[model samples]
Target chain A: MQLSNRLIKWLISGPPLVFLLIFFVAPSLIMIVTSFRLPGEFGGLAPLTIFSEHTSIDSGLTLETYQFFLSDWIYLEIFLKSFFIATLTTIICIAMAYPLALLIANSPRKFRNLMIMLVVLPFASNFLIRVYAWMIILGPESTLSHVINHILGVLGLEPVTLLFSPFAVLIGMVYVHLPFMILPLYTNLEKHDPILLDAAQDLGANRWQQFWCVTWPLSLPGIFSGSALVFIPVLGMFAIPDILGGTGDIMIGNLIKDQFLGTRDWPFGSTLSIMLTIAVLGATVFFTWLARSVMRSP
Target chain B: MKEIADIPEKTMRHSSPLLRLIAMLVYAFLYIPLCIVIVFSFNDSKLNAEWVGFTLHWYQTLWHDHEMLLAVRNSLFIACCASTSATILGTMAGLAIHRYKLKVLPILAFTPLAMPEILLGVSLLLFYLQVLNLTLGLLSIILAHTTFCIGFVAIIVRARLQGMDESIFEAARDLGATPWQAFYHVTLPLIKPAIIAGALMSFTLSIDDFVITFFTKGIGEPILPIQIYTMIKVAVTPEVNAISTLLMLLTLTLIILASRFDSSMLRDPSR
Candidate 1:
């Protein structure tokens, strides 16, 4: 019986475990290993002979790639810019999503699901195509811009370029990621009980106090999870910036893509990817700690 | 009593008008871009500068675009393969984790979800090209998608399994049935809806995936999003809009269907 039970467990779990090992873990290991190898003539890792030669001499590894990234002020600036944009996107999403989530949660039961569906429906569409839609709307000659420019002309102001600008990139990032923020916030808010608000009110609390003492405190988990969801993905997003951002709007994701695809520099690309992963993991840990401490306080 | 009961309602009515306006604007921000895409699909303009008139010219052009159609076919093919494989593997893992209480299974299952897509893409690309020497095409894409998609499927199935009552299997065993018989007869039927929902969700995600597919899909044929990316890079045309509208409609239908299955599973308590 014991043997059969063990057999069944292995039967059930073995395939997925093996699959992940081969496809996911192995690839990640390869990426990390390749990051340390010296760059070759054509931009990928050096030849197998060189790798074998280096295996004998300190595992044939070098710190050049890491050194390059660490020493470069430009790469640091790009990472900082990505971090700033991600922070901005998260803040804006929270500001927009909180009230909306509150309203939806407070709505009558029959309308609640419909409202939630409306929020989620756009997320079903292609992400790239949605960015394209923004391109059309924000294009200089499109109807939206035409209307804006006409108003500006009437007001004796100069027409402004909208597409391929940093502002357009920011708008695209927020739009693409808003659903990520809203879903978690809505989930957390929907569980809120109205009786708590009434209880706070009866305890001599006014509206602002009721919200601060009741609702805001209750929704911290949502804010944490939602911010993580939005911020991390936005930090590493390539497509939005690729489609909507100008030359000055380059982020780390674009830099990684250029290294891999354009420059064909696999080692440097892997290094950047590793840096991004570490940064994201660090942020996640910090946020998790922050959430715990905040929840523990008062 | 009536006056006292009216207090909460009165307080609800005191919710600010500015809040409602912001809510409306948020919805507009969420939806107007998609609506614009659909609208421009029917626009008669070539450059999409101004709407000349309502026409289906772009749709007609999309029909004749063999490369785009081929990409769509390839996407559908890959999505079907990836989702099915991921669902099977995920369901097995979910069942195992639920039954055995494995210590590391949960963390392993969720790693894909927590990892960034760009990292997944680059790593998988490197693995295929350098370690495995595998060609980058439909096969590579299917593998990469299935790896991440398995996480989603496993998470969903595990949730369903957790909500399920374990007594049914016990009852079956108590009735002189073998473990396999009990699982096949009782547990399988109960988790069928979850499996279907996971499969549909996987399909949707696979079809919409761009970053991972972009890295792993080597030169044979592009998926729909890849084709759309190339087209937009060269020029913006209404034909791309028409195809996008079609993809959106398809995805929305699948989402609605998937949600129906999900809600129905939640509603039914017997399983």
Candidate 2:
């Protein structure tokens, strides 16, 4: 009976464990090792050792890639710029999503599902198509751009280009990720007790005061969770910048992509990826701490 | 608009006019671009600046384009292979985690879903080229898709299992049934809906994926998203709009079907 039980256990769990360890775990380790190695003569990693006429030389590993990353200010600038864009996107998502989520959560229970489904429906569409849609809307010949430019002309200001600008990039980021913010915030807001709001109102508090004291404080956990979802993906995003932004708009993702495909610098690419992973982990920890404290204080 | 009317009067009184307007504007923001894309697919103009007249020229162009057809074929093939393998592996992982309460399996299954997709793409690229020395092609792309998709399937199935009664499995075992028989008769029938939902979700994800596919798909093969990417980058045409509209229709159908199987699948995995 004991032997058979053990056999059943292995039969069930064994394949997935072996598959993940081989494919997921092994590749992650390879990426780390690749980060420490030197760039080859052409593109990939260099040989572990070079044998000369006289002696065998070990050229296997170096911290040169890390040194280059720390020495340059451009990489740091890109990191900061990416963070700025991500933060702005997260804040905008919250502002837009909060009112909508609150409305859905407060609506009749029968209508709540349909309302949430509407938010998710657009998200189910192809992501590239969503980005491409913006390309059409923001193009100079589109109606929106023409209208804006005409208004600017009437105001005696320079006619601004909408496509391939930071504004367009921000719009695309928020559009692609807005549903992430709404879903979590709605989930959190829906669970709030209505009696608490009634109590606050009975205590002679106005609507705004009730929201500030009771609702907003209670929704901090949702906001933080939503922010993390929006922020992390935005940091690692390359397509939005690549397609929507102007030539000057390069995020850390674009830089990392360039290393592999453009420059063929495997070591530098891996190094950049490792740095990004650290940044993502740091932000996650910070968000968790903030959420915990906010939850405790109330 | 009808949805707004359906809101109960007490709750409607609570929602301020400013809040309603903002919510309406937010819904508009979500939908207007998609409407424009669908409308423009049949447009007669080449520039796509304004509509001239409705025509089927773009759809005809798409039909005649051999490269686009091949890309569609590749995407369907890859989505099928990847989703099937992921469903099998992920169902096992989910069952094991629920029954055995294994420590490491959950993290190994789920971290891929949370991590930035580009990291997985780059790591797999290096592993395939440097360690395995395999050429980048459809096979490599399928393997990469399966690795990430396992997490989605596992999460759904595990959630379904968690909600189920443990007594059913115990009853089967007490009735002189083997462990395998208990799983087959009691557990499999109950979790069927979740398994179908997970499989459908995996299929949709694999088909729509672009970021990971961008890095892992080495040269020469024309995948659907990459084709669309090149078209958008190189030039704007109504043909691209037509393809986008069609892809949107397909995804919409699949998503509706999946939700019908399991409504809880609509909830975010982070929940």
Candidate 3:
């Protein structure tokens, strides 16, 4: 009986663990290892022939890949730009999502579900297609831009070129990630007890005071998770920038793609990948700690 | 229930006209692009600037485009296979984690959720090319999709399991049933809805995935998103809009079906 029970446990857990280990964990480890290796003659990664006299130091195991990235101002600029854009996107999403989530949560039960469904329905479409839709809307000659430019023209301002600009990329990022922000906020807000608000009101708290003291603090968990969800994906977003960004608006994701596909510099690509992973993991750990500390504090 | 009624009154006062206007605008932001795409699919001109007249020529063109059709078929095939495999592995893992008190299992299972898609894609690409020495194609794409998709399925199934009553399994076993029989007859039926929901959700994810597929699928036939991507990069065409409208409709249908199954599961708990 003991043996059979053990067998059952293994049978249940073994497949997923083994699959994840082989496909997910092992590949990540390989990427880390590959980042330390030297680039091959043409572009791709060379074999990691360590401590061999026949191999040159440049082509052998070394830290040149990391060093190259650190020494390059262009790469640093790209990383900083990616971080800035991700932060901006997260803030915009939160601002846009908070009231909307509150509205949906406070609606009648039947309407609440329908509103949530409407928010989620756009997510069903292909991400690329949706981004493409933005591309059309933001095109200089499209009606959306035309209308905006006409309004600007009435104000004696120059016509605005909307597409292929940093603003366009920001708009695309916010548009694509708004659902992620709204869903979590709505879930959290929907579960809040209305009695708490009434009690606050009875205790002589005004609307803003009640919101700041009660509602906002209670919804911090959702804000953390929602920001994490939006920020992390936006950090690594390549397709949006590729479609909407101009030549000067390249992010770290674009740089990584260029290293791998366009430049064929596998080691450099792996290095950037490692840096991105660390940035994301670091942000998540910080946010988790912040949330826990806030919850624990008075 | 009285608390619910009084709660609305307290909350409704906060929903000022300005707040309602902002909410309405946000909803418009969320949906206007989709509506525009659908409308532009019928545009008579190739460019998406002006509405010359309403016509189905773009849809006709899409129907006749054999390459795009092939891409769509490939995407569906991959989605089906990847989602099925992900469901199986995820269901098992979900069961194990819920049934046993494994400390590290939950964290390990959800790591994929936190990992950036670019990192996952790059790592998988390098692993395939360097370690496995395997050619990049549909198989690699499927493996990558399943790897990331397992986390989503496991999460859904775990949530379902947490909500489930364990006594049914005990009852089945008290009636002289084996462990396998208890699971097969009792627990499986209980979690069947979650498993199906997870499968459908993963199917949608796999179909919509482009970044991972773009990185891993080297020199092979393009998937639907990749094809659309390449077409858009080369030139803007109304045919792309037509196909996108179709893709949107298909995704909406699948989502509705998935949600229907999920609601039914929630309603008929005795089953």
Candidate 4:
């Protein structure tokens, strides 16, 4: 019986473990190794051995990609810009999602499920469709642009193009990522005990003070998680920037994508991916630490 | 329930007018774009700028487009294949994590869920081309989709398992039933709803996937999302809106069905 049970354990776990190992683990390891190697004559990695080539060129693993990334300021600038955009997007999502989440949380229990479903429904649409919606809204010929530009024209100001700009990119990011923010915040806020708020109010605390002293502090975990979801995805997002962003609005995602698909520099692409992985993991750790410390301090 | 019922009506009406207004605006922000897409799909205009008149011209164009049809076929095929495999493997992974003290399986199952979609896309791209030396097409795409989708299914199934009454399983064990027999007669039936939900979720995810599909797809086949991407990047037309509306309807149906099968599963925070 014990032997059969053990066999059953392997039966249940082995397939997925093997599948993920082959597809997920092996590929990730390959990406790390590819980052160290040199670019090939065409696109992929260069030959590891000198015997494959007539000329004796430095081939097998090297730190050249990392060195190149360090030597150039543009790559660093792109990283900074991606971070800035992700930060701004996360902040905006918080501001927009907080009140909405609060409302859903505070709603009658029967309606809460329906409300949360509504929040998630838009996300059922394709990601590109969500981004493309912004393209239509922000296009110069669209009503939004025409209205805004008309108002500006009346005020003797130059008409600003809305379709392919940093502003448009930000809107697309916020639009697509808003649900991620709302869900986590709603989940967190829904669990808050109403009795605590009542006690705070009875103690002569105003609404704002009650929120600050009670609700806000209680909801920090949700906020942190929501921020991570929005920030991390935005950091690595390429589609929004690719479709809606102007030439000047390139984020790290675009730079990495360009290396793989456009420029065909596999090694460089792998390097950018590694950097992005580090950035994402680093941000996750820092925010977790910050959340811990902040929670501990109070 | 009693505590919530005991909360004063005054506190229950905590929504200020200002808060209501902001929340309404946020809801609009969530919905207006999608509303416009569905609305514009029927628009009788090339530019999608205005509601000139109601027409199904773009839908007709989409229906007749062989490339679009082919892409739809490929996406359906991939979604079906990928979701099936993911459902099987993920159910096992979920059951294992719930039943055992395994460490690596849990991380392996869930890490893909947290990582960016593009990372999975690129890594698999390199793996297929360089390591497997496999031709990139529907097969590569199916593998890639399955790899990422296992996490989603596992999460759903695990949540379902966590909610289940364990005493029943123990009772079955004590009844002199063999391990496989107990699993077949007991656990399988109990987690069926979760398995269905996971399958539907995987289907929607696989069909809607663009980034990973973009990397793994070869030049030969026209996958739906990639085709839509090309059309959008190259030009803006009502046809794209038409396709978007239809695709939205498809996924919306799948999501609604998944929620119906296991309502609590969809709302799981750990998802």
Candidate 5:
């Protein structure tokens, strides 16, 4: 069944590579190219450059679009705000996930299976519908705050605002992405040797010391994987924030979406997207680097 | 990596009341929003939070809302087609890549996994509209869904194939079965769980998709997500809550079906 080396290579890689290069890679290249295209408020094609009324490319270059975006305080604000929200969402997802993962790791098989199903079930619901559900719970007359207030009242404490803030956005993120965080962590946690813990405890390790020393170190793969899984999606998340967040909370995804669809500024939108891509790439590299360094040190 | 995994054993002699409490707290945080939506689904009023007692009116309304109903129909139709197409394409691709020595192919094939979906959406949107010069409705959506879904199916199927004892195919072939017959009777049956899981997963993904759908979907052809998207933008209503609850139930059913098949797929492929 073995073919010649050259023929085998062609048969294996050729068609798929060509297919992806045409559709996936080429389209991305085109997008980047389009990003460089000078933009019109309405619709027109021109080369890119900045400030030279004589410089707007008919067939030449102009930076007006990039300059406009750079100078626009609102654009910059939205960009920063988006990153801040994505980070908060990632943190919230982690906080909600790790405990569930631990419990699932230790739970009975039937319960674990049922819980895993419950974890993934929400994910299969339509994105807009999921957001719609949150909107109902976060709306002005929402029962969420009303009930929270009731419970807090029993304890003689005022209920906290749970809707239409970055808080609500974080809640939505935790709600939607908790499964993602749990799955990888659970996988890693389950892979642990039962005797390793026994061996560690047999040594004279304190509980916190054991956790800080053995458990956390072994769980880094899961932690990092889950973080990436939750964080990447959280970065591009648009549906939840737009639905749940008040005017104050915005993320880069939302900004990019609005620029293209709402503001009809493809150039600015492309620039923002380019920046977001770079940021994501940067974070991924940093995380990977940190992980390697940790591994290498002693 | 070792530290957190070692925490439980160190604390093994003690009960994990704090951990259990935090677990419950987290679960409540996750589901309380869902519970509200579920309760509101029965409300007879426009005001979602202001429930005017229980009524089946929204369920009745579900049958009558022609536009929303059509959108759901479109979503179902597209999902079915996309899942089928993707399962076939991806499985073939998976077979090709795994069985053959395709060094450069996998990296390119799996790039879609790394690339942010937003970039894919925008790029695909441009490719179809600007380059292809064709405005699409259901067809484009199906194509777009398949392009992404194929990767998932391929990965699952390839894993299943890897788990197989290759000698089954050899034995079948030795028993005078043709290549196609050996594959159909032996290999295909063996990998049924993976195939089912792959198909179901892609279906779920197609039904739930938004980002890619957002860019590729044509005007007036609202899918289920688009329907909900438009409705929520106007105002949150109990009916929307009803829709969400129903979707939750449907998705739960699908996930259970998929996962059940998946557990076996990874374990018993060689059996």
Candidate 6:
């Protein structure tokens, strides 16, 4: 794909480019401008109008807005919360996915696709809906807890609180993002030759060692992609915390949304957003580098 | 990486049960909530967990709710419209870039996909709210959706387009056909799977979209997931369960139907 000058090609590409340029890029540029807004003395956002509001143009352009986020302990805590949730979600996803992926790959063809579909179908809805599903299912006296406790009561232990805790958030995070993990692992694991497994067992290696030495390493490409896919979104998820965590489990995403949509603090929100984006990009780069090094191993 | 492979019978003594336990527990973790949602949708009571008796009242309630119908209508309309537009544009972009050797367009085209859904939503919100001074509504949502939908279409279409044997198009052109005729006679037929696949992928992504729509939707009721999010703020109701159950089924049905359309032989109308 070399860059070439062609009238017809440009014309063909013109519509989508123009549409995105006007709507997507333009609005984004405008938001960046808005993100720089300084708050007025009355705690209202100083509007960024070029016309009437421009009479006091000097009133705009302040670093105080961004500084607010840099100083706020609550915002920083929420940012760390987002990271923790995403990391926990990634670990759980890999732990579960590696096994399920292996089983599905070894299963018969018809069931394999069906299993994959079952895993991914849950993802086909707005991700928020699945979070809502968890809220209902995880609440104290919730059906799931009730059932589990009813069984545990056979041993006389009390019912437990699984909802509205970090544990609940973790469950929702892992549940919703597991498919991202499974699909990648399955893609890599499926390419695996079964004869390798037969050969390993013939060599007298146990199931655990075989996985540690071979399957895990072979599946790293998938593991990397899937983990990144899960972790990146989970890092900024607002809805899961809002519903399942209720008042307590607020994450950095909620804080950013609060800044722009709630508090009208554009600068602080933008700063936080920039930070979050950088964190994701950095982590993805690190993992990709790790994967590359593993790939080049002798 | 390794030469050795198969497992020994003696090794199974310690680990097989542990793996089975882990798999069972994880699957339970995944589906038990879904099962509860299905069950409560049939509950008689207002409170979700409190099942007074089996009742279809929630389904009745959802059907009668005008706001729910409007949300459904708007969501379906936007999803359908956006995917159709994205599919055509994506197919063109795929063909143009692959066939005509376009440069820099590749990276610029997909940069939109790299942006998080939240940022995309907020940026579009600002565009519609401040710059354009347009009210939040279905139109804005569709516009927002199609932006991301383009990436999906481009990926699938490019995949299909690349899979074709380039010689077929060459032969058609060499046989005295015009570029349009060569494309129509050879290339179009070849890449139809990717086009169809991309279109379906685009549609599902749009249909299931929440992040972008959350920012762009201006008016009442919003989409189903947004409504569900708000409902979670109140109390979890059997009615919400019923709605989710219906949506889950609808999504599954659409997927099943889309899978049936994966025929590679689109040009041969006889096939």
Candidate 3, A183-262: lDDT as tens digits: 88888888887878888999999989988998899898888888888999899999999999999888989999998999
Interface RMSD values for the candidates, listed in order?
A: 4.6, 3.4, 3.6, 1.4, 4.8, 6.1
Q: Whose TM-score is higher: candidate 3's or candidate 5's?
A: 3
Q: Specify the CAPRI tier of model 6.
A: acceptable
Q: Count clashing pairs, candidate 5.
A: 23
Candidate 1's iRMSD = 4.6
Top DockQ hit: 4
lDDT of 6 by residue, B132-219 (tens): 8888888888888888877667766676676778998879878998767887878778777667767776777787887778778876
Per-residue C-alpha lDDT of model 4 across residues B62-170, encoded as one tens digit per residue: 9899999999999999999999999999999999999999999999988888878899899999999889999999999999999989998988899899999988888
**Model 3 misplacement above 4 A:** A51-59, B1-3, B6-11, B263-271
The Cα error of candidate 2 at residue A159, in Å, is 0.3
* True interface contacts reproduced, per candidate: 0.60, 0.57, 0.68, 0.68, 0.44, 0.37
Candidate 5 per-residue lDDT over residues A258-291, each given as its tens digit: 7656866666666676777777787678667766
> What's candidate 6's DockQ score?
0.35
The segments of candidate 4 whose C-alpha lies over 4 angstroms from its true place after superposition are: A50-59, B1-5, B268-270
Q: Estimate every model's Cα lDDT from 0 to 1.
A: 0.85, 0.91, 0.86, 0.91, 0.72, 0.72
Chain B alone, candidate 3, TM-score of: 0.93
* Clashing residue pairs for model 1: A54-A60
* Weakest lDDT window of 10 consecutive positions for candidate 6 chain A: A1-10
Global lDDT for candidate 3? 0.86
Clashing residue pairs in all predictions, respectively, total 1, 0, 0, 0, 23, 10
**Clashing pairs in model 2?**
none
TM-score of chain A of each: 0.95, 0.96, 0.94, 0.96, 0.83, 0.85
Worst 10 residues of 4 chain B by lDDT: B1-10
lDDT of 6 at A292: 84
**Candidate 6 backbone clash number:** 10
lDDT of each residue in B1-271, candidate 2, tens digit only: 2344454354343478899899999999999999999999999999767889999999999999999999999999999999999999999999999889799989899888777889999999999998899999999999999999988889889999999999989999999999989999899999999899889999999999999899889789999999999999998898999999999999899988999988987766344
What is the Cα-based lDDT of residue A226 in candidate 2? 95
Residue B20, candidate 1: alpha-carbon lDDT = 84
